[model samples]
Target: MTNSENLLEIRDLKVYFEVKGGILKRTVGHVKAVDGVNLSIKRGEILGLVGESGCGKTTVGRALLRLIPATEGTVYFNNQNIFKLKPSELKPLRSQMQLVFQDPYSSLDPRSRVGDIVGEGLRVHGVSNRGERHQRVLEALRMVGLQEHHMRRFPHEFSGGQRQRIGIARALVLNPSFIVCDEPVSALDVSIQSQVLNLLKDLQQTLDLTLLFIAHDMSVVEHLCNRVAVMYLGKIVEVADREELFRNPQHPYTQALMSAIPIADPKIKRQRIILQGDPPSPLNPPPGCRFHTRCQEVIDICSQVIPEQIDLGNQHFCACHRRQPVQEAATS
Candidate 1:
């Protein structure tokens, strides 16, 4: 179990990419990939970051690790402002923070064996003893259910599931306190997806890892995360505990998303929400509520002004013009 206090605090983080055009290649506009997102993660709990493709979920995860620079805002890891730290100061903190990328196949090198691939971080961080690195690599691989002999083989030699395990092993090798799991199982088969998620949960429990699980799949998030935050057009639409969010989603975008999760039993009747049209382009998103264009229950105020995040006690919050707390809305 983890403490209730936040281990990672992000405030008003923005990552806008300048778009250049014309023969002059002059900066025309900006892609607001991440726009003023705020979040906090406890020391050992898994926080799910969910949103549609191109909604900047991955960007948020990348920014938290400083893999991508933030145009504005601050990231505080355990009360230390990471962005203000110099390169030399940042180096030691790297082992404490790591990223398990989305594509396992592309992330690993074809030229390197499993041992070298997993130990690359140690090598870069000056863990120069080959003997020590080898032992650490073996231990990490074993933690993810890969055998010692498997370390001699290449990444291409393993199945999709095995390769993901290797990727998890790569992150674990550093013994990092925080990991950004950027849709680690999205490319795998359904059967393999659960296995990888389970492995991650088990490892988190064993090692007390704090994870930011980024994915578009709500079912996976529901299964693994203690709390879930729904993102829409770079802003967090809603955030609450997993059970509360699923049972009483407060935002229109979140309600539509939760409704789309495929259920196993056909006998159970659940309302299905089909959103029309694509999400607004990040290059030029809609004003006010970014989701106002696609929301089914759109109000006049939604199109005119941005809604403030309203608190409903118990840390549950949402940005919506019409939605009230679950109890009040239900009783009304």
Candidate 2:
């Protein structure tokens, strides 16, 4: 897609964290948290990234907002190179880009009142004048279905769901064009998750906001994302529209993930493709296709060389050496 059509474009993004090992104070290796991830977010679209834990879904979201420095590659926000911006030049852009982190309980300041926590962004961005910031905070709270009276209470006073709502409110108070929801609903009860998801959908449409919704739950991604990308061992295995992915998953990893989603119908039983062994550690990622070791239909090519993302009609992309055109629709 063209630059004007995309809200956020990330090309070959990589984030590595330095790690020390052995007793000699020697820098052993780096954790390849996000290794060569490439994706784009269209204006006002929810792009979901899904994978197992430690798969770098959260790290990609954090790196997009510069919460962590990227070791290599480019992050373009509205076609502007965000990494090139100096700290001062990036300050204004910060207000336009926000994050609603997971674990709302620890994310909020326990000592501060909810109002102050939510309004902190407004204050930092020089929306001085306490009255105006307070007004914005209340409005933001109301937007997230919280009352103004609740603002005076501490974070510990609210339930897990309410805490997440406050976190959403904090992100909203800045009136950002884009928001990274880093597994925002993962910590809440299943019943409460629907409430938060519906609220996010409502708010997205109301505000015309773009979002990068990261989660390990395929069910949650199917419910909220316009498109979904499956990740495995710090790499994107496949990316396609929601219906396309559900109906015609390309990669083996994506298929495995889709099969695990519980089927509601009693008569329609699904066959789960259980992968063998644990995922390889990012500190020393396996060469070539990371999923090859566990993939049931692995070919010789999968082990020796990395797969190139290929388009299989409809712009669906997959990076599996054994990926082939399906004669039938996805069973599950």
> Scored by CA lDDT, what does every candidate get?
0.91, 0.90
Candidate 1 lDDT (Cα, 0 to 1): 0.91
Off by over 4 Å in 1: 1-4, 325-332
TM-score of each: 0.96, 0.95
**lDDT for each residue of candidate 2 in 57-165, tens digit (9 for 90 to 100):** 9999988888889999898898899999999989999999999989988899999999999999998999999899989999999999999899899999999999999
Stretches of model 2 off by over 4 angstroms after superposition: 324-332
**The 10-residue segment with the lowest total lDDT in model 1:** 323-332
Model 1 per-residue lDDT tens digits across residues 131-242: 9999999999999999999989999999999999999999999889999999999999999998999999999999999999999999999999999999998999999999
Error of 2 at 157 (Å): 1.1
Clashing pairs for model 1 are: none
